[model samples]
Target: MDPLNNMLTILDAEMGAPSRIEKTGSWAVRFDEYQQFRIGAVLRGDIWLRVDGGAPRRLSEGDCYLLGDGKPHVIGSDLTAPASDGDAETAETGGLETARSAAADPAAISSVVLTGSLGLDQATEPLLRSRIPGYVEMKSSSYRSQVARPILELLSRENAWEIPDADLMRLHLSRILLIQLVRTALRTADGCAAAPPDRLLTRMDERIRCALDLIHRQPSKRWTVANLAAAAHMSRSVFAARFRTAVGMPPLEYLEMWRIRSAAAVLQSTDRTVSSVAAQFGYSADSTFSRAFKRVTGRAPKQYRQLAA
Candidate 1:
């Protein structure tokens, strides 16, 4: 599998069903900092989006954005407009919620935005945080528009009609949209970067990906920074520096995290004893394994298993 797909699988990311946000006249909504990844598309009219006190940018019809930084942001017809809490304007419509301007006039509705979140687990949050920018904008004029436009159109159509399995269809389409957006973002310049892209993981460096794939595919294997660098065809010092810059952590540290996290999953799901599970993931001693597990999970194997059971 590709690196992004592999990381998604490990993270157990779930793309939630989409919601429609309709607004009229001068309206702005503030979305507080959130933990789950967020995606939004302007399906009609134009809106302004600002993240974490950053300058607002205009998003025309068909434009979309993905949020990875978990920072507070605002979206509206006008950035200078008085804002309302996004949560307060939410109302259920046909099993899905719709957000509207504080003083909404249905007849004068000017903007329709499609938004959703991708739920992920703690184990792989760092992988996303380190690789993806806090915010990314995919413009309608960009090369990715060919893929994004049709998907957004379909989502808009699905939201409007009452069809068979409509909820399921929207859910699936939203997932595809998010996946495509991330895939494109990895290949293109990250919008959040101040200068021309100079980061390692933001642009999907193939060499770094190769080293990451090896560690992810075989976390149980004994790994060292030097070996990982060698696999990536770089000298030890260069590889270590690059790996840290790309992943926000050293190679061996990442391997340990993956190993402990994978072992935690096994401990929770299977009947295997602590030592066997530890050994399966390359832990040589029960005491050592227990210490590592505790450090990561705040609980030892037996305690964790019992709680899970």
Candidate 2:
């Protein structure tokens, strides 16, 4: 049983099934509250996004933006343009302030922005942050041609009630979008190099994936670096070096993080006591688990459970 493998499995399970399509306005449609990752795809016409004192960025047709945290932001034709003074007072129709006051009405707009909100957690935020610029415009390009266009078309036709498979489709599309964005970011980060060309780092990714799979599959097992390295088919020294390069952390540190995260979910979602939860993740004692949990989360397990509950 590997703790890292357990963590990944939990991530997969805890990531909620994406919710119903929400019509926000003439210009915006969002996913249900269950989603932590939100994506807004623009179709037909343009939309503007105003983020907390930042200049508004206009999104044209076939353009998309991902909001990692689903924070309250303004999206409309003119994010900078002020609304009618009259509509400014009503809470719902009160203009820019009101846009964040409640979810936008999707039926009110013609051009659409597809929003896929996935509840903003650490695992998911990196995927969104690495790709989206403060504002990036995708012009006529093969990437956009192959990906964004199809997603926009599907979003345009599918109604919340008419489409039974909408949620699954959205999830799949989001995954595709994330992968494409990651590839693009990696390319840029690597200066357009065709490959990372670092054999050690490449091997490290494979090893980390193996380690991650082990932890996700069986979190209850007491895991160690020696065991994890063997799983990667490398000696500890080589495996550790490669894992650090690929994942930016040592294997044991990654395992600890995985354990703490797993314990957190159980603590939050179940009535299991701290001791039981700690033991579930292979902690020999509650005190040790508490210390580790506090170090990672800035709160003891008991405190976290209370707050989460």
Candidate 3:
């Protein structure tokens, strides 16, 4: 499987669903510095967004943004707009109690903006999050509009009509929209520095691709810098340097981050004991894993599991 797809699948597993948000013209909302990731898609009109202490930017229609990574941000028609014009009217469907709509006009919904929280790996701090900026954006014009536009349009159509399995269709389409959003984010220049047009997974040399594949396929394996280097057919030193240059981290360092992430997925999805979880991922002892997890995630495995629970 593609390494990037492998990593994204893990993220979705942890953040099983989205908390939908919808708004319209000149509306604004403020979100606290979050521990997890927040993603938003503007379906209509435009949005003026500003991360804390960051300059504001205009997000036009058909834009997808990674609002922030554990940073507070404000979204509105302008930076100075009130945090919230008023409470939002929420609707439910398919037994999922989400769908946020800002009813500024009782007559009609002026605009539609959908936002979802990637509620996963809050404790472990997934590796991809660090490589990406606190606030990154992907505008649809960068790629074919057909990719996300159709999916979202289908959602809009299904939502406005009372048709068979409309709720189920919307739910599935929303998830697809989010996946396309992230996939496009990885390709857009404005989305991430590490993911320039020819960077990310597109321009990976064969060696680097092989190494990444190995790591993703079996993160539980006892993978050392030398092992990855051998897989990449490079000396340990050369492989380490190249991996760092391309991926923004030394090979083993990235591996540790991946291990912690894999452990986190297991912890959130299953009822395994902390020791068992650590051992399953090749950590020699629970204490060793706990210390390492703390250094990276700011919490022990047990504590992280409890909080997630």
Candidate 4:
């Protein structure tokens, strides 16, 4: 496969589908933690989105926002309104459930936000994940999201009904649109105009590419800095520095990060025991892996599992 395709494929694996996809009305999650990759499309009406204390920005119908790094953001009908939580209200356009504020004015919220949780938190594959972006907002009219707009429309239409086939179609189309959206967003990055964004995978420093591939393709392997350097055909010092410059982290650190991220996905999506999950990732003792996991993820394996659950 071509380099761009290869990178896209890797990113596809990293992000997967939008977990816990939902369409909500007048939404605002006050304590925003950008822990999960989020792709949101304004399926109906208009909403205001603000991130990291920035000014509120308007997202009209057909706009999509991607948060790969999970930068916290708030979206609602009115940004200044107090955070409200109530039973989900049925959407007029889509059969999706939307949260309605319990207030005297029933028509207070007119926006239906289709939110998809992109689980990048579960996959820290350094090569593609770190290189792209953590936060990006593109309008349907922008050069970046031209194709994304149509895909979003299809998703909006698919979500509008309760057909049995609509579920599968919505799931698959959401995944496709996400990959396409990420690709377009990366193209707007620096030096992207001169080269295909995926060239980062194919056109990387030869040695660094070798190391990155080794780590991502074999996260189960017990790898060391020495092994990665040898794979890159560089001296230890040169390899470490070059790897940092190219991939944004030391070789060994990347391995641990990838392992922990994999562990998170497994823990969140499965009923696997901590010991078994740790062992699967090459940790000899559950405690050793627990410390490593906690160091990287801020929660113990069991605790993280509970949170995921």
Candidate 2, residues 49-166, lDDT tens digits: the string is: 6655566677776676555433455666644444332112222221112222135545554454444333323432332343234333343344643585565445434423356675
- Per-residue C-alpha lDDT of model 3 across residues 59-100, encoded as one tens digit per residue: 888876765467777777656656752223222421233344
**Model 4, C-alpha of 21: deviation from truth (Å):** 12
Estimate every model's Cα lDDT from 0 to 1: 0.73, 0.53, 0.64, 0.63
Q: What is the C-alpha RMSD of each candidate to the true structure, in Å?
A: 7.4, 10.6, 8.8, 9.0
Instruction: Sort by TM-score, best first.
Output: 1, 4, 3, 2
TM-score of 4: 0.55
Best by lDDT: 1
Query: What C-alpha lDDT, on a 0 to 100 scale, does residue 214 get in candidate 3?
Result: 87
Instruction: List model 1 lDDT by residue over 21-103, tens digit each.
Output: 88888888888878788878787899999997688888998887888888888999987888887744542431245776657
Instruction: Using lDDT as the measure, name the better of candidate 2 and candidate 3.
Output: 3
Better of 1 and 2 by TM-score: 1
Stretches of model 4 off by over 4 angstroms after superposition: 10-31, 85-95, 103-109, 120-125, 142-171, 189-195, 199-207, 213-233, 237-309
